[model samples]
Target chain A: MGPLIPNGIITGDWNFVIAILVGIAFGFILEASGFSSSRNIAGVFYGYNFVVLRVFFTAVIVAMVGLLYFDYFGWINLSQIFILPTFWPAMLLGGVIMGFGFLMGGFCPGTSFTAISIGKIDGLVFTVGLYLGIFIFSESFPLFKGFYNSGNLGHVTLTDVTGINAAWFAFAFVIIALAAFWVTMLIEKKVRKKITEYKF
Target chain B: MNTQTKNNYKPNYINPYLGGVLLGLLVLLTVYITGRGLGASGAVKSTVVTTADAISPTLAKANAYMGKFISGDRSPMYNWLVFESLGIFFGGLLSGIIFRRIRKPWVEHSPKITSKTRLIFALLGGIFFGAGSQFGRGCTSGAALSGSATFALGGVIVMLTIFGTGYAVAWFFRKLWI
Candidate 1:
């Protein structure tokens, strides 16, 4: 009844149209949320602003709970949805590298696009770097191709790994997210007080 | 009056919780419709493949990584993520216009550092994120956010490691943001 494309409810021709609509919504929400500002994003780490954390965690929990409900109602086939395959070492290396990128650049790929839309020169430069980096990666593919494809644990989820029901995991994540929100609110107050040089 | 003006200077953005809900619902709708989640870096990869393929057909095909995306029938740029990414740019533009955030292009950096220094770091960071996305098979949007929302183990791993590493290294780069 759902996953309209896969189920033949929506044809292939509409795929790109849907993609565009979805992306528009994604970008619009991000910009309106203040994600276009690099400083706002970096504030998460500095404890000056917790907007990133709040938005991110709330989104995660909402999606998680929403998915569970969709599955329960049989509106969407959970099995039909794509789950990112686990590649342990590759993902670990990638995440570590991206962390530094986030701290330094203060914009992820999605966020960077929004920055560029708002006429950010830094965003433009960073995007150029993205092209170069990808080029370098492609040319150097032979060097790490083996490592890239090595740790393939295909399409497993947290429930699959820990044998806990997905509901419990969602519940735990909600609790954790709520707790983090409270803690970060306190931290933001303290941090903002100490730092008057930068305008919030 | 000074404090009031300072408060007024704050960015006029939606509440985080509301933004989160909307974004989350969007994710849900995307999955419900497409049987897949959202992505950002995939479009960049496609562009790279298309450009490399155009520049040197033989060389692009000969390469181990770029070769996989090359096809005889259609351009690599004719991909879903690529089209979606175009939408993201336009959407951002719309929001910027509505919010009046569009301005003459300038570098945004902390007062402690020069714009030159900020741009350099931004490029370096972009390089790392670009390379890492290839290794990670996605960036924050495609991997961490969309991945975790779907409960994928890889998503969880990537999410934890990314934030964990950011916290671990935040102190060293304090001047950049703080």
Candidate 2:
């Protein structure tokens, strides 16, 4: 009944078109939620604001739970979904690099695009840098190919590797999200009080 | 207060939780429609491949990673992520227009750092993020959000590492934000 493209229900050329429409909604929501602002995005780490955390964690949990429901109700074939393959060492290293980048740049690729649309010079520079980085990686591919392919774990899931049920993981995520929301609210209040000029 | 330089615009940001719910639903809809989820970095990757293929097809094909994207029937520009990312750009523009948030180019930085310093870090950050996305197989939205929604183990790892590392290095980059 769903996942129309993969199931032969929504055949042919419309798949990519629909992908664009969905991506538009995704981007619109991100921008409207203050994701267009690098300062707001960076606020999650600084305690002045937690919009990024609130939106990100909530969205993840909701999608996780929704996927479970879809599978349970037979609304979609969960098995047909594409899962990102895991390379443990690469992920760990990549994540660290990205983390450093995020703190320094205040915007990720997606958010930077939104920021650029609204005329942020920093966002534009960040994107140019992204291009350069990709170029460098391509030219130096032979040097790091070994580490990139290390710890290949196939396309495993949390349930697959942890032996825990998806429902349980979702439940744990919900609890953690709620707690973070509570704590961040307190932190934001404290941090905002100390600042003099910035207004959200 | 310098009234001339300041852009007096009312910031009407949507409620964060409601926005999150909408984003989550979008993710769910994407899965239901395409048997996958949302992504951002893949679009940039496509651009990189397209540019490389044009400069030197032989060199592009020689690199194993670039070859997969180059050997495709049409140009890499015709890829799904590329089309979707275009929509993302337009969607963001539409939202900015509707919200009246459009402004002249400016850097958002702390009082401590000069605009030049902020821009420099931003470029450096982008470099690290681009390279890292390749290694991790995705960025925050691609690897962390979409991958996590599907319960992928790599998604969890990427998510943990990104935020974990952010907190670890946030102190060093404190002047950039706080």
Candidate 3:
């Protein structure tokens, strides 16, 4: 009854329109959460602002719980959901590189797009850099082609690896997220008190 | 492009927790409706593949990575992510307008560094991100956020590594932000 597209309730042609609408909602939420500002985003690391952590963790846990509940009610078939394939080595290298990107650029791809929409020059430059970087990667694909395709473990979830029920995992995440929220709240207070130079 | 000395002041954003709830529900809705979660970097990948193909059909087809994405029957740019990304731009614009956050073009960075330095880092960071996403197969929206939400092992791996690396290096780059 769920995943309307795969179930044939919503046709393929509607995917594009749905894509645009979903994207709009995604962009609006990100921007409205102060993600458009690099300073605000960078604050997650600096401890002055934990909005990034708060928003991200909360969103993940909520959705995680929602998925579990949906499956419990038999509203959505868990088997039909897409799971990202685990390519360990490639993802590790990629994650490390992206970490540097986040530190230097202060915006990820999605956030930068929002920043660009609001007339931020930094966002525009970062986006152009994205283009140039991808172009270079495309031209030199042979060098790292092996690395990219290596370590393929297929689409596996945490439950599969840990032998934990999906519901219990969702519950555990909620607890951890809540604990982090408290600790970060305290940290943000202390950090903001110390830092008067940077305005959020 | 709408650069002017506009929007000198804008209101604060919604509460983080509230924003998270809305975002979470949206993610749930998206997956329930489309059978897939949100993505950001995939759109950029499409752009790269489509652009390379358009520029050099022969060369694009010869490349190892880009070659797979190329097909003579259709343009790679016609993918869902591209259209979705276009909508993201429009959605962002709409929010900016409502919040009066749209303003003259400016570089956001720490006062410790010059704007030129900030812009350079931004570009370099973006370059790394582009390469990384191709390697990682997704970015924050696609993997860390959406993937983690579904309990995917890859999602957890990405979310941990990306943030762990962020924490690992945040001290070194303190000048860039703090």
**lDDT on C-alpha atoms for all candidate structures:** 0.90, 0.88, 0.88
Candidate 1's residue-wise lDDT over A95-182, tens digit each?
Answer: 9998998999998888899999999988888887788788999999999999999989999999998999999989999999999999
Candidate 1 Cα errors over 4 Å, as ranges: B1-8
Top model number, lDDT: 1
lDDT of 2 by residue, B99-163 (tens): 98788888877777799999999999999999888888999999999999889999999999999
> Which of candidates 2 and 3 reaches a greater DockQ?
2
Give me the iRMSD of candidate 3, please: 1.2
What TM-score would every model get versus the actual structure? 0.97, 0.96, 0.96
Clashing pairs in 3: none
Q: Which predicted model would earn the best TM-score? A: 1
Candidate 2 matches the true fold with a TM-score of 0.96
**Interface RMSD (C-alpha) of each candidate?**
1.0, 1.1, 1.2
The docking category that best describes candidate 2 is medium
Better of 1 and 3 by lDDT: 1
DockQ of 3: 0.74
Q: DockQ of each model against the real complex?
A: 0.79, 0.77, 0.74
Fill in the DockQ of model 1. 0.79
